[model samples]
Target: MATSEKQVMVVGFDDHEHSAYALEWTLKHFFAPFTSNPPFKLVIVHAKPSPPSVAIPEASEILRYTEADLKKIAARVAESVEEICRNKLENEAIVEVMQGDPRNVLCDAVEKHQASVLVVGCHGYGAIKRAVIGSVSDYCAHHAHCSIMIVKKPKTKH
Candidate 1:
């Protein structure tokens, strides 16, 4: 990581927990060198749920977001990301709001942006839950071209 070359893409979701922390961690840990110098870039991705997954609740079908609603939602997601990185990221992170599966959108961004690293947070699912749903963190770890870091939330003892 030199002053002239630094490009990191951080993916975020509606939830502001471990993934957000991981995004910050990516900047502080992985891309520290560039932050200390110059020529650094960070891209934050906020993705909307896809069609089948984002469908209306069970019952008589009622239309959810039309074209306009979708636009508004995307804009809001981008805005939220922008706000988070406004003064926090020293490298001037770029925020993007996309609509689709989180993993797919992130993978596409990684390729399109030529990202050096991809960072995301894990939900910390139990063994059975993970086996059932298939964790995004697991998917990225396997699919990402570059290095992947999955930030795990610190467990609190009851």
Candidate 2:
């Protein structure tokens, strides 16, 4: 089947264990049976913070350093994602690194790809922390224009 003809599944990813576990779980449950051709095309989306814009002479140097650091982080994220999906998927997963809040970036990716499902990892934050930091999964669940799946990492027994 043609790549464009297949349904798209957008997975929100980052350098976090929660997201990694979500991707692993997704593959094991949804894509394991069909090694040759999965039902949906996987697209991993990573959202990086936009660099601050300041109008100070000294800030330019800082901006340059920050931009370089961000680039390194993006590269590391792409490598990690590739490694995670290397053996699990027959078709290479599309990786997108966008600048913005994760909630907005993920929803935008879903729209851009015309995805049928949006998968995100739950941070399992408490009410206070969620209110303060803002839960990306919660925001996507409410705002995204498709089915949303928030995967929670299973608690390990000590």
Candidate 3:
């Protein structure tokens, strides 16, 4: 009764400095004294790109390369990444790897997990360039089902 309920905050992570910055930013801002709760739990989510449509020419007749096969490989990679991240992060988190368009994949994860917040990082693209090329953070900001936090600062290593 004293501690209140805990919600889930889905954080988009790709094992890079930008994404790491977002995670750290959220932790610093939401959690206090580096060890307090923020009314939510951090859930690390990564959207693995869909497998190329190229078929295994030799195995096409029997067992052809399918999206599921590629997903299996991607899952392994995601698992490895999750292990490293979990070991490095100070707070507890959950890891989820999904497939398809990154924008839709991330949004879907938010809805599926019923997350209360989606923390993402700005890719540092200029407005003109972002308008032309598009940005994942932009897409998430517009489409995420929950509250979105876009960390714009670059990671600084001292």
Candidate 4:
């Protein structure tokens, strides 16, 4: 039996600091083929909120925003990733944004894209808060089908 080729998809939001760090992380860590090799796809996911005017709608309603806006946000996030990649890996990378839960959506993308690795960032809420609210990274780490990388942001100096 032969090993299948590997692909990577990184998931996160462009608005959050931790997500930005996560993007930086994927660029630094998830190295696929560079020269004459299968390209790795970077996925930056943002959950657009449902508009308030309309009555509560189905899950699909959550992603009602324009694709242009979504792609622009994803591009900005990817630019950060690209900067990190150029400095560290000496290469540019491909990036995309898909809407949904950061965990479920990412895992789904991994399955759809047949990605071997999934990288995401963990934003640490206090233990009490996390116990009640749950964290996206924690969920992904436990449930994702692919090899998962959970990036953590460093503590800020007071």
Candidate 5:
């Protein structure tokens, strides 16, 4: 079948433990018994922060260095995601590194990929923290065109 014919599942990955857990959980629950033909096409998205616009000469130089560092981070993130998928289902996935706020990037990816579902890991932030920093999952739940699944890592036994 053509790629577009299959339902797409966009997974938000940020090189964080929570995101990794979400990917693992999704694979275990939905793609278990690893068939040659899974139900949905997996697409992992990593959103990199956009460089700030600074007018000062020194700031511009700093921004250039930061841009390079961001690229390195993106590469590492892609590699980690690939390793995770390889170890789990041995399945192939498209990994994209986008520049923008995660909430916007993820929602845009869903629209671009025509995804049927979007899976994101929750940071388990308190109300104040979530309000201040903002929650990507919460934003996506409201803005994304597809169904949103916010996976929260279970608390470890003390």
Candidate 6:
């Protein structure tokens, strides 16, 4: 079978539409071609940011938020991503939710999984905002260990 030489591919996911669209496009464009060539395994990764260091004066409130809570949420999000791709994907997909900087986390996952490609959606960041906040897509494009595909949403007519 073409699937004998299976390779791993990673897609950066969020609960948002752009992320969903990226997954759809990947399945349609990239994965569909897998049947003829070597089959590829898909992994959707979400890098959940850790809680912020806000100045909440109440120690009790801070105590209420635990690592377990964050991990639970991350697991739920991972499941959702898996659900999105379940129907169309040829094989079962792996959903991983990690905590850290998104760019670094995704890159690490690619390296760890030995993925052939990393797919992400462009958030339409303008020059100034991207300059200020440093776009994750931009960072991963340059930094990811594997090949990267940045899917941009087409502008809709007003």
Q: What value does the lDDT take at residue 148 in candidate 6?
A: 90
Cα lDDT over the full model 5: 0.91
Per-candidate TM vs. native? 0.75, 0.94, 0.72, 0.64, 0.94, 0.82
Distance from true location, Cα of 51 in model 6, Å: 1.9
Instruction: Report the lDDT tens digits of candidate 3 across residue range 37-154.
Output: 4567777787777755546677554444566676776676567656655555556677778778778888998898888888887779889999998888889888887888888875
Lowest lDDT 10-residue stretch of candidate 3: 59-68
* Residues 40-151 of candidate 4: C-alpha lDDT, one tens digit per residue: 6555555442234455567445545554566566667656656655675544455555565565776676677776667776777888998898777777778778787778
lDDT of 4 at 76: 72
List candidate 3 stretches off by more than 4 Å.
1-4, 32-38, 55-91, 155-158
lDDT score at residue 44, model 5, on the 0-100 scale = 92
Task: Tell me each candidate's RMSD, in Å, in order.
Answer: 4.3, 2.0, 4.4, 5.2, 1.9, 3.4
TM-score of 2: 0.94
Q: Give the per-residue lDDT digits (tens) of candidate 1, residues 1-158.
A: 56556565556555567776776566666566565664346778877765444444652243344545666777876776666666456656677777788888888888888887777888889989988988777777888788887787788899
Question: Would you list the C-alpha lDDT of every candidate in the order shown?
Answer: 0.70, 0.91, 0.74, 0.63, 0.91, 0.82
Residue-wise C-alpha lDDT for candidate 5, range 20-125, written one tens digit per residue: 9999998888776655777888999999988888988879889999899988999999899889888887568888999999999999999999999999999999
Model 6 alpha-carbon drift over 4 Å, by segment: 1-4, 33-38, 53-57, 66-73
- Candidate 4 vs. true structure, TM-score: 0.64
lDDT of 2: 0.91
Candidate 3 residue pairs that clash? none
**Model 4 pairs whose backbones collide:** none
For model 4, what is the alpha-carbon lDDT of residue 90?
45
Minimum summed lDDT over a 10-residue window in model 5 is located at 29-38
